[model samples]
Target: MTKRSDFLAANKGLRVARAGFVLLVLPHAAPDAGDIRRFGITVTKKIGNAVVRNRMKRRFRALVREILPEHGLAGHDHVLIGREGGVERDFALLRKELLVALDRARAGKGDPPRGAKGGRGGGKPHHGRGKGPRPAPESPQT
Candidate 1:
């Protein structure tokens, strides 16, 4: 498990954006460092009232605790954003989403391709390399 101080130190690290979520990932640059990772949850007032926000934060914390050991990067700082409907969603779905997002963040930072890009087709998916995917083309059926 990563120490709280380490997480604080990771405050300035990589960041990834997704729908209903924003992942802040800070990779460990120093060699010989231990494989330690910590997670922080941020839910702003815009998300909801105290109860709702707290629930969201709790959910995020739980999700991180469950998945970090397997997928979390060493000496990294991670903050998961809690958006509207986040707290209301199903736990399994949320967990799946969180894992996928984290994987995407890791890969985006250069993990390697899983199967070429999906049908989304914005060229090869450059993990964390550029601005993200381009907007989809509009349909012309009239």
Candidate 2:
């Protein structure tokens, strides 16, 4: 769960959205030695400044710790992505949402593809972020 690759892999899993967060559940083809559940939380810069992000992270950590052990699906990797304005919501409300989301996930129901919405993730891939590829290094300046 600490590695970037772990998060990326979870992104390809089932996604359930709530008012305050998005839950991603990915099951391992086979569990590790202990068949334990592992989870991670991500709060992006878009959420706010460092302090705000840290606060949101703390809340997420508390919620996961309180609920996951009993309600979570075993042998899966869970990732909670904080959404904008999540910080303003009440913790109890968020906890309820998480529980509902986890139940939906346990039932193998996930929200629709986020890319289906217009003007966002879906579209042609950008060739590159730069103006364009360098022009063959100008032929080594002749």
Among all windows of ten consecutive residues in candidate 2, which has the lowest summed lDDT?
Answer: 133-142
- Highest-lDDT candidate: 2
List ranges where model 1 is wrong by over 4 Å: 1-12, 28-32, 109-142
Candidate 1 clashing pairs, residues 3+ apart or interchain: 108-127, 108-128
lDDT score of model 1? 0.71
lDDT of 1 at 93: 84
Candidate 1 C-alpha RMSD relative to the actual structure = 12.5
Residue-wise C-alpha lDDT for candidate 1, range 1-142, written one tens digit per residue: 2465655554555556554667777766566557767577778899988998888888888888899889887666677867787877888888887777778777756322333345766665556777767899999999
lDDT of each: 0.71, 0.90
| Error of model 1, residue 53, in angstroms | 0.7
Q: What does candidate 2's lDDT look like per residue over 7-81, in tens digits?
A: 999999999999899999999656462567899999999999999999999999999999999998888999999
Candidate 2's displacement at residue 66, Å, is: 0.5
